[model samples]
Target: MPHSERPSKRLAVVTGANAGLGFETARGLVYQNYRVVIAARSEHKGRAAVEALLKDCPEADVRFEALDLSRLASVRDFAAALRERETALDVLVNNAGIMALPQRELTEEGFERQLGVNYLGHFLLTSELLPLLTAAGAPRVVQLSSLAHRGGRIDFDDLQGEKGYDPWRAYRQSKLAMLLFSQALQQHSDAESWGLDSLAAHPGLARTALFEHGVRSRALVGALFRLTLPIMTQSAAEGARPILHAATASDFRPGDYFGPGGFAETRGAPERARMSATACDAALAERLWQVSCELTGAMWREETTT
Candidate 1:
């Protein structure tokens, strides 16, 4: 279907809608007439964000819902709530994610913090919500990734960073896993005629709380980030455009990746960006899919296989 022809009355669920690219993506979707559900980890922040969005766009159909992607039970509960409330979901933006934290942490579910929240959590969430997404004529799943994925390696033996952990390395691996998952999802959907579009996008380098979160936890690193922000950062709104385009643009194809189109994809307008070679590896994509299924215990394989 053409982009213009896509239904405007659709419902969109955006994770991490309390701030950064997720907030901006919600705003853009609201402007485009989508009834947006802002899924956040904190009720206070989510409510505050909804109020702020309404202040700018009084008619914006935006609501807040609590979701902490680091917890599998929370993901299941969130998915169940959405299923009970809505008959169909036209767009699901797996936008909530964490970046480099100085120390390795584990989620409530016992997975590496970054991997748990950024990749595995979304993996399970999407799988559980597949019924809602599939109910719509053409649903879209947009997985938010990062350029750092270029240097990532899927350490199967050390997926949880239990053997050893470097914050940035773990973050990169998680983001790469997200990209590969999106790609695998697209391929699976196509092979099974699942009637959904799976796409990936990244916010090059945007000045968001992610950087602040990194710095606040470590002074020297925080200082370095503040020092470099002016030279490397782009506005959150600009960074979110690729995600919006991938979610709503008519030209999108399954497994397509989008991002800023300037200065090594660091800062510019949104465009169809190229993914890293590692992210495009079919073998790794399949391996990640199997591992994700084992972790989430989601019925994705059964649904697609049948």
Candidate 2:
């Protein structure tokens, strides 16, 4: 039998699963008996993550596939390959993201680095994978947003930041875009009767490699963050709770956003978090959806597989 025709267990894909919250999300999904794919840009790190997962649960169904969000071609190729091998995708965690980069950089496609990798990349990936997701009885897509989204502005005039670039501003826009995308996707799904759930989540100050190695890590802000880690941060596993909940919970609405439930939503169990006025703007989401589709040349697959 061809690989695509073979019967298998429920399947999931978690981008950036090589470490941090993404790894923990994959771990939880594997334990739940889903055949999880650890999608990351680095083959070595991806394989290592698979190894670590298997070490804990030797029978866990998990493997790695290369996916570099910085390149739109890579996103397309990854989606195409997965479609050839899987008849359905039960869950997709858009978890991979690059935090603040000190220097202004552009992706292979000339997109702002942070926006390209964090939001646009996932946008295209989810668009490409729509067919596989829709084939499942109940599919779910989880987008990773952040607290920083509150300060985000779309800045359509300078989405690429050609005029001016501030690391945190770019990061904020990307995260807010993720949240807006989640809501927009849910709306689209409802309108098209896609029968899929789309939700967003935030980790609420989790201490992960992204924080330790990102732009903030180099300055006094980084020092302060590190100093307050014990009191203000949670582990990656803790951070994954909101994502896992958003991905698997039955009671959540299609467009709900999840995050930590403690004071200022810094750390606690998963729960519905507050949304910024900008994030709730349906008009903006629609505009972004159109712009993203134009930028990535993404077309949501309308056909469904049996």
Q: How do all models score by TM-score?
A: 0.92, 0.96
lDDT of each: 0.89, 0.93
For model 1 the local lDDT of residue 156 reads 96
RMSD of each: 4.1, 1.9
Global CA lDDT computed for model 1: 0.89
lDDT per residue as tens, model 2, 1-306: 116463568899999999999999999999888999999999999999999999999999898999999999999999988888888889999999998888999999999999999999999999999988998889999999999999999999999999999999999999999999999999999999989999999999898889677636458887888788899889999999999999888879889999999978989999999999999999999999999999999889756344
TM accuracy, model 2: 0.96
Clashing residue pairs in all predictions, respectively, total 0, 0
Clashes of 1: 0
lDDT of 1 by residue, 1-306 (tens): 113333458899999999999999999999999999999999999999999999999998899988999889999899888776777789999999888877889999789999999999999999988877887878999999998899999999999999998988999999999999999999988898778999999988887888567556767877876788777778889889999999999987788999999888988888888788999999999999999899878786322321
Model 1 Cα displacement at 274 (Å)? 2.3
